[model samples]
Structures are given as C-alpha cells and as structure tokens.
Target: MRHQPFETWLLFDDPLTPDQARALDEHLRACETCRALGHSWRSVASLFQASPDLEPAPGFANRWKARLVQEDQGVLTARYRWQSWITLILIANGVSLLGMLLGMTFFDTFDSLTEILLVLVYRLTSLLTVINIFQNLLAILIRTIPGLLSPSGWAILALIVSSGSLLWVLSMARLARMPGRA
Candidate 1:
C-alpha cells in the first residue's frame, strides 16, 4: 500500500488538519509497513527526549584548537615547499639558458658548424659532470644532516633556507622587472 501522507504525518510532530488526519489513519490501518515505521519513530523520539545532556571532557576545546593550528601550519608548510621547488626549477632553467647563450656567443668565433657543434657537446659534457657532482654532494648531505639536527634545529634550518630563497627570488624578480636591463 502507498504510505505517503501516513509516513510523513507519523515522522513529523506537526498537528494535522482533519482531512490529513483521516487520510493518514486510513493509510496506517491498511499498511503494516507504515504502522511499524510510525511505532519505531515514536520509540526513537521517546529515547531522544529521555537522554540526558552531557558536557564535553575537560581540555577538549584546547586540544581541538591546537589540532586546528597544527593542521593550518602543515598546509602552509606544504604550500611553501611547493613554491620553493617551483622557484628552484625556474632558477635552474634560467641559469641553463644563460649558460647556453654564453656558450653560443663564445662559439661565434668558430669558422665551421662542426667546430660549433664540438664546442657545444664539450660544454654540455662539462655541465653534466658539474650537475652529477652536485647531486652526489646533495645525496651525502641528505644522509648526514638529519641525524645531526633535532626537530627544532631542522625547523630553524628550514626557516633560514626559506628566508634566503625568498630574498633571492624577490631580488631576481626585481631585477627582471627593472626598465634598463637588456
């Protein structure tokens, strides 16, 4: 049987009009499901009414606030790390381009295309060697540094490094924006 108005009337605490009340009564009588639902809803409502209100445990608010602050800090840290990586990548690309341009300028003195290509290959090999050396040094530093520093020490080190990187990025941006640079 269609429950409709009967289920709605049973679930809600609103006083029904005489017509709605008559319809709901007829539905409830015919529909076993609606009758059972109405009974269950009443039981639930009574349980809710009888349940006592209780206060939160002590320090709950303070702990919740601390958690929120820690979460915010984590988000900020992640953002900063992402931005730092992007800045580092941009800086590396800029340096590589500048190096290539300088290499091309130097190769301009050469008479033949073969000599230019040879010089370019030699410069690329030298650059790769330097990069490999730096990568090895970075790997060694990563392995060694964590054991040497406490959490606070690491934080301080991070702050110093980030500040330096920020200053460098800002300076580079300012220089790029300058009107007179060729």
Candidate 2:
C-alpha cells in the first residue's frame, strides 16, 4: 500500500486503522516534511488544550466599544473637513465669477449686447486666473501646515488640484473659442 500524506491525519481523531497507521508510519520514516507537519499539528492541539478559559476584565468590552466609536468619529471628521473645504472653494470661485460678470454687464456701460458679452467673457477669464492663483496658494499652505506636513500628502493634494485646474481651464478655453459665441 502507498504511504498516506500527512493531510490524511486530520480526517481521524482516534487511532488510525491498521493499514492506515502502517502507511503513515512508513511515510513518516521516509519524509521529514510529513513528520514535521504531524508534530506541529499535535503541538498546536496540545497548546489549545493546556490553556485556561477566562473572561476578560469588566471594562474590556466597554473599552473596545469606545475605541470603535473614536475611530468612526475620526473618519467622519476627516470626511467633513474635506467636504467643507471643497464647498468653500467652489462657492468662492462661483461668487467671484458671477460678480465679475455682473460688474462687467451692468456697471460698465456698453453700446451693444455683443460688446457687453465680450467684456463679461474677458472678466470671467480674468477671474478664473485669479481663482487659480488663490487655489495654488491654498494648496501650498495646506502642504506647509505644522502637523499635516508630509511629502505624500502634499503630492496627493497637488496632483488633485493640478488635474482639476487643468480640466477646468481646458473646458473654459474650448467654450471661449467656440465660433459665433459672444
């Protein structure tokens, strides 16, 4: 009969049958790997059997619950900070753009609608440039903040802002260059 692999040992808790026992004994004599596996399994089983079963301290569950709550709060706080910052930046940019258009259209007298629209477009472009400068400055400040200064954090922030600005500029430029538009 062929020798049994060590994995077969896990199938039976009681003593192996005569043929199976003989096969395992023969394999263990020839294979150091199988012998070591069997030894390790027995050692682990013995360790589990030897250890005493005891309940944790009275505050253990409470401590773990508190820890989980703290972790959740940390995640929520970070999410809210990011959202608020983005929202503020967006609102500032939108208000600035709208103010520029209103100033150019209503405050500055133009002889024709075309002239007024052209002025508004020019002002919008100028406002976008100003916004970009301010956004870059903000990114630099974020990167330099005392406890938040990390190369990876700065790199990620720079990447996100740069990509966003690039997309915004490209879309705006395309719209500005479209023929028949004021």
Question: For residues 71-142, could you state the per-residue lDDT of candidate 2 as single tens digits?
Answer: 998998999999999999999999999999987868567687898789889999999999999999999997
lDDT of 1 by residue, 1-182 (tens): 56776777888879999999888888888889998998888899899999999999899999999999999989989999999999999999999999999988887789898988998899999999999999999999999988998999999999999999999999999999999773
* Candidate closest to the true structure, highest TM-score: 1
Model 1 Cα shift for residue 51 (angstroms) = 2.0
Off by over 4 Å in 2: 1-17, 25-41, 53-55, 106-108, 111-182
Once fitted onto the true fold, the runs of candidate 1 whose alpha carbons sit more than 4 angstroms away are 1-5, 19-35, 112-182
lDDT (0-100) at residue 127 of candidate 1? 100
Name the TM-score of candidate 2.
0.39
